[model samples]
Target: MRVLGVDPGLTRCGIGVVDGAPGKPLRMAGVGVVRTPADADIGERLVLIERGIEAWLDEHRPQFVAVERVFSQHNVRTVMGTAQASAVALLCASRRGLPVALHTPSEVKAAVTGSGRAEKAQVGAMVTRLLRLDAPPKPADAADALALAICHIWRGTASDRLRQAVAAQRLRTPKGTA
Candidate 1:
């Protein structure tokens, strides 16, 4: 499956694309970071995110969008920014009629580095090795985004999908003990 992973922020949003299946190495399609000037108004920053996300979707045409979940924080300001960013990212996927999956930081870290406590550098190194790339993905945020994509690919719920498909098929059949 083709997946678009996003690490969202008010001033800088990172995005990455990859194709992979469960228990397989992810093939990196591309990685990019979108930046808005710190001095820009909040509205302008949000607009930038919306446009940048749309452009990425158009270019990648991913089958799924994987996003980091926003966690509650002690700092109100930090929480607000993260919440807003997450909302916009989800909106972007919904607008495109794409399926979205969200994972926690711990889940992504563990998936990328085999330990939830793995440092950013460790995660980056693992991402490079797992993808068999010449170099590590640039900008820590972009690396994190790529990691998210890899995590989703590795941990997707194929069995759940199968169950749902089976239920739909049963519904289509006539009432009988087939």
Candidate 2:
């Protein structure tokens, strides 16, 4: 499966593409960041993010989009920007009729590094080793994006299959059955 992972932020949104299956080796198809000027108006920054995400969707043509779920933070301003950026990503994927999965930071960290509370550097190191990269992707955000993709590939595929199986079973079962 080909998946595009998005790490949304107002200043620098991370984008990464990965190709892999649940029990197969992974490959990095692409990785980059979308930068918006901090001084720019919020609306303008969102537009820039939309454009950037659209370009990535065009280039990667991923089957699924994995985005970092926005979580609460002490800094309300920071969380607001993250939520806004995340919405842009969700919009872009939905427009393309792509399956979207939102993975929390803890889930991503645990999937990649065996610890939900793993440090950023540890996550980067694990991502590097998992992808067989010569070095960790820069700016932390880039690495985080790749980690999101890896997490989805490892976890989302199984979840999808389980969901499908349950739906199929329900269809096969008689009506009014428990």
Candidate 3:
């Protein structure tokens, strides 16, 4: 299945698309960022975000979307913009009746780099390796977004994977086993 991962920011939103299948590597469909003017009002920026997400959804047709959950950075202004950007991403996914799951930053980092506290550069490095690309994914923000997507592809609950795990366990156990 195709999953779209999003990292929402006030000035730039990161987006990554990956296909998830058990025992198979993540297929990097695309990676990018949606940039908004720093001086623009929040409302207009939100509109741009919404349009960008919608465009990605229409183009990629991902089965699901995973977005980074909001966390306050202490600065009220920054927090507000992150929230708005996040809302636009969620709204875009909801509009298509797609199930959207949220993952925390630490969770994304751990999934990508074996450490929850991995730096942005580390995450970018692992993302580059995971995708088998020689050059790092362009633009730090976009690269981070792609890493977030890769995290979800690795750790997100996939129905088929779950079903297969259950089936395997059942076969290994005796009848009526607990």
Candidate 4:
């Protein structure tokens, strides 16, 4: 499956496309960051981000989109910008009818590096190693976006299977108290 992972930020949102499945070698289709002027109006910045994400979606044609879940930060302004950018990403994928998944930083780290608390450098190194890239993606954000895609491709499929199995079991169970 091909997944477009988004690491959303107002000033610099990272976007990456990865193609692979569980137990297979993942390949990087593309990776880049979308930058918006810090002084730009919030509305304009969001529009810029939306347009950039749409372009990536159109170009990569990913079957699924994995976005980094926004976590609260001490700086409210930063958090708000991230949340806004994230919403734009979600909207883009929804409009295209692509399945969307939200993965937290810790979840992506754990999936990629076998530790929830892995450092950024570790994650970057692992991402480089996993995709067999000659060097790590720059600015950390690009590598982060790739990591999100890698995490979803590896874990999302298994999660989907588990959900299906549970649904199947529910269908077989009669209506009664457990």
- The alpha-carbon lDDT assigned to residue 133 of candidate 2 equals 99
Ranking by lDDT: 2, 4, 1, 3
* Cα lDDT listed for each candidate: 0.84, 0.91, 0.81, 0.90
Cα shift from native, residue 165, model 3 (Å): 20
Better of 2 and 3 by TM-score: 2
Candidate 1 local lDDT, 20-95, one digit each (tens): 8986667999898988888888888888888899999999998888898888765788678778887889988865
Writing each residue's lDDT as its tens digit, candidate 2 over 37-119 gives 99999999999999999999999898888999998865899999999999999988866557788999999999999999999
Candidate 4 — which residues are off by over 4 angstroms? 159-178
Which residue pairs clash within candidate 3?
none
- Candidate 3 residue runs with Cα over 4 Å from true position: 158-178
Candidate 1 RMSD computed on C-alpha atoms after optimal superposition onto the true structure: 6.8
The number of residue pairs in model 2 that clash at the backbone is 0
Which prediction has more favorable TM-score, 1 or 2? Answer: 2
**Cα RMSD, each candidate:** 6.8, 6.6, 9.3, 7.1
User: Against the true structure, what is each candidate's TM-score?
Assistant: 0.86, 0.89, 0.85, 0.89
The worst-scoring run of ten residues by lDDT in candidate 1 lies at 159-168
